[model samples]
Target: MTTHIPAAAKIVADLKARFFPTPTYRQLQLEFDLLLEQRRANLRQGRQQEVRGLLVVAPSGAGKTTLVARVLRQHPSGLRMLTEGEERADIVSMVVPSPATPKGVGLDMLEALGYPLRRDRSAHIIWQLVKTQFAQRQVLFLHLDEAQDFSRHNNHNDRHAVISTLKSLTQSPQWPVGLILSGTPELLDLVNMDAQLARRLKPVEHRPLKTSVDGGMITAALRQYAAAADITLDDALCKPRFVHRLVHAADYCFGILVEMICEAIGEVLLAGEDILSTKSFVTCFSRRSGCPEGLNPFVVEDFLALDVRRLLQPEPGPGNQGRPR
Candidate 1:
């Protein structure tokens, strides 16, 4: 039997698939292509060289992870089918485990490569296996998201060890793989602690959005998404004041802004509404943020005065910690 999917769900999924390639995404994609090409060139020439890596630094909601994933998915040589049941990916993507020790990250990489450890192993041994697996899989890039966790360690030696492991991965003579380290801006301090590592990494930053600069783009995105949802946006919803409030509501993060637009569109679609209005956004904000109409940026007169960022924070209660609303 075929299960029926809700129209709202289908529309939301379609909306998400429409990627808005911001200038920052384009720049990062170009840099990634260049790095991959360089690696390919060196391999073809049989030259033994250390591979350089990218350090992507952005705020929590800037969509760094999504941007990187899209780039990997679009690359021509990013994936390969080795056999009927075996596949090899050019990039092995994983999140850096909390505490961010060498052993933790090494084991995480091994698991992502589909080779989980079967027995207890030392940090040294685990990393050796990780390198071996990476080479065996013919992986070209190792992407570690949330890499800022590396700096959570207060011990000087511990932090240095993590940095050293990353350095060793790129410099491994037998299988030098490029690295993609993406995290918040705090990751810069972690990388800079070791001068050699800092020099070897290319830094790419995703800046927050500004109403004056990004208003047109945001408006276009809203219209595009609304049309995809078969809803017509109200004229007043695209006004400068409403646009500014929308930006404020999203905390000036591009990813969050796109999500807010989609959320508003989803609300309209689900509500059986043909015309999207500011009230739709007001309802969306109230539902997601658990804020009353008075405090919501979409409903408030002076949106800039409201700390919309705080709306995403969880209330103090059982089963509510660390979860928005």
Candidate 2:
């Protein structure tokens, strides 16, 4: 972070300052740290037996993607992704999931696990490759994010095929170490649609934050986000509406909130402000909203279009459908 710079260095720094001020090495943000810890502890303790796995569903603004990205980054098991890499003999996260064609999706997973889908190979070949290569790679987990899109199939057969493949994965040779599926409530319902899939997944559903959670704990998370962006809410800013808005912003899935706050805070700074103002606070709602500069009016429009009640929709499944004990 040296400020002094040579002429050539100055240009590079200026470009970076203007375009990529924030480092791009994606990592878990502060907001979703708590939820990440809870999940990691669950996986580590092998206490996954309580439910088949976990299901994290929230409204549009809930920040589920950020949390998933963090777990992908920090999960000790290795962040498996679909993109091809060289040193990928061990960590294999197959991004072979599409609501369109179940077989194609499965093939994508095969490719991610280091299985070469021999040029012009048959679908069966791909499926077999996925099975064997995954075993060879000894992947410990299969986390399918944005799973709600799985319903994008053309026919009932494809859906069943997708469900069957998922079920088989859970009962794999590796004892199906862990299955973490995340998406909106509709995704949870997709699992429910297939009784067998629902039985196998044992989803871990996420709950919304109460009006107040751990009083100081939730506030502490808010403080961390504020600190990250070099912005702090003043005592005067703690009026009922302001406090409620701040809390609500922080309430969504923590990991996402962190990503969102980073961008939102960037807006506050770019505006040449010393501290975040109420107008700034309301304007910077989400990372998407803070795109191309200030909050995009459309993000607010999409959110406003949907009733906020989706944020607090009761768990839609028999699993933990009742109040938490």
Candidate 3:
């Protein structure tokens, strides 16, 4: 006999396929495409000039990593032969280790490029290998995700090592690969270390939205996601009050907000409901936060007076710990 699946689980399974692109996501996508195209042009021109790099900074949970990954998906990494009859990477991306040291970062890059390592080499040795391998691959572009780790808990010398290495990679008579540095705001410290480094990279900041300014956009995003999931949202739950509360609850993070909405939708699906109501959201928040109804912003009528931070994840620190790829 076949086991019956719960309606909620079935609906949530269907919702898994949905990808709601908010206004911010759209803007970032465009910027990334333009940057990628510009780099491609440089490759075509065979120009050895110093191709400018991009640094994207955002708070933890602001979706900096996800945004970059989505954009990079359009340019899949593979081997391509240069005019010089040498194999080169179309694009190479990797996450910088926590409290990233120059040597550790170098090894990470080598690993990302599919190089075998015995872990017996020094930072200097690993870097030499990296330069050689990168040259062989003719890597046109390199993306360092969670790059804030470069400066996180690092001494001045360590920080400088990482920065100088990055600079050398983009300088003339070397690889001259276009760089993409993405991480939390702490990444600015790494960029600001060298005035020249700051000048070389363009900054793309992702700041949290204020409810008063972004309420309409947030509301639209919520409605759009519900519609995509083939469900209706309650009119009350779609109002600015709910939107503001959500923004606050999510620490004004777009990524967190999207996840919270998806979780709420899942809750609604589990209940076999056709409409996303505040009650469903209340359940979602309560479950995520492990808070009673009185403290849950989605459950209480006077949610505006409640401090949602108490119920959310602990604030991010300089470490900004994330999964390693």
Candidate 4:
């Protein structure tokens, strides 16, 4: 016996490969290009440059990591440095550890650079290794995501120490690595404290869409994605009520908005439906958010001013064991 697959399912699979590069993605790409050019010039000239860092700042789900990672792919590493005559990385990327400290950050970088640390050592020793390995590998660019985590557990003095470590990497006379730091807005605190650090790093900010500012863009994108999936765009989905509700449900996050749309589309495909409907979205929202039908924005009437925070709260359920407050 042969199993049948729905046409909508095939379309959904095709849609998975689609990437709609928004204005923010383009802007970030342009910034990365300029920075790469400067780094190239420095490598060719054999000198450290004044502007050696770039920071991409955005909220939790503004797609900072996705955008930066995509840009990083465009600049593949593992090239030989002309002066050093060794295998060198054009760009190396890693995430800042949660509850970050100077030492943890060093280990993260060392690991990303493929260094082994079998023995226990001090932060100073690890960091020394990091700088030495960076020079040896001829790494010209370093990209750190979730950079705000660096400030999570740091006090004033500790924060300054972390900042100093970052500054020194770019200040190296030999093999100065251009830094790309991407994180939430709080990452700005790392630079604001030091005037020189602030001056050396350029900032690229990404923000979410608001009903007033990005309503048209959001609507157009939704329609485009629907058409690509060979599904009819639900009229309710195009209305202001549903659009803003989606924005709110996604915490005003662009990445999450995309996710919500994709998940809803997937649900329609699974249901073997030809038209995307508010009911499909309602089911998706309830399943993901754990909100009841009355509170589900997709289903509820007079949901204009509904606060979505309740959906984000953890409630006891089949998979979760109750804990005393």
lDDT on C-alpha atoms for all candidate structures: 0.81, 0.50, 0.74, 0.75
TM-score each candidate. 0.88, 0.62, 0.83, 0.83
Q: Which tens-of-lDDT digit does each residue in 1-325 have in candidate 4? A: 0122455456656675566687788887888788778777766887666446888888877788888877777545433332223356666787888778888778766766667675477877887888888878777778888988877679898899888888888887665677888999888887788887788788876776787777787888789888877789878788887888888777687877887787788788777676877877788788787867666667656554455545554543565422221
TM-score of 4: 0.83
Q: Rank by lDDT, descending?
A: 1, 4, 3, 2
Error of 3 at 254 (Å): 0.7
Please tell me which predicted candidate would have the highest TM-score against the true structure: 1
Q: Which residue pairs in candidate 1 collide?
A: none
Residue 145 CA displacement from its true place in model 1, Å: 0.8
RMSD of each: 4.8, 10.9, 6.5, 5.3
For model 4, what is the alpha-carbon lDDT of residue 133?
Answer: 84
In the range 1-325, model 2's lDDT, one tens digit per residue, is: 1222243243323322321111111222222333445545765876433224445566554655545555565556455453455433323433326544766676667656556465477656666666666555544456677777776543666667667777776665443434567677777667877887776554333555443552344445445555644567445443444444444455444443444445545545655554645555555553333232112222232222222222334322455232221
Can you list the residue pairs that collide in candidate 2? 31-254, 32-254, 32-255, 52-202, 53-202, 53-204, 54-204, 55-204, 80-93, 99-152
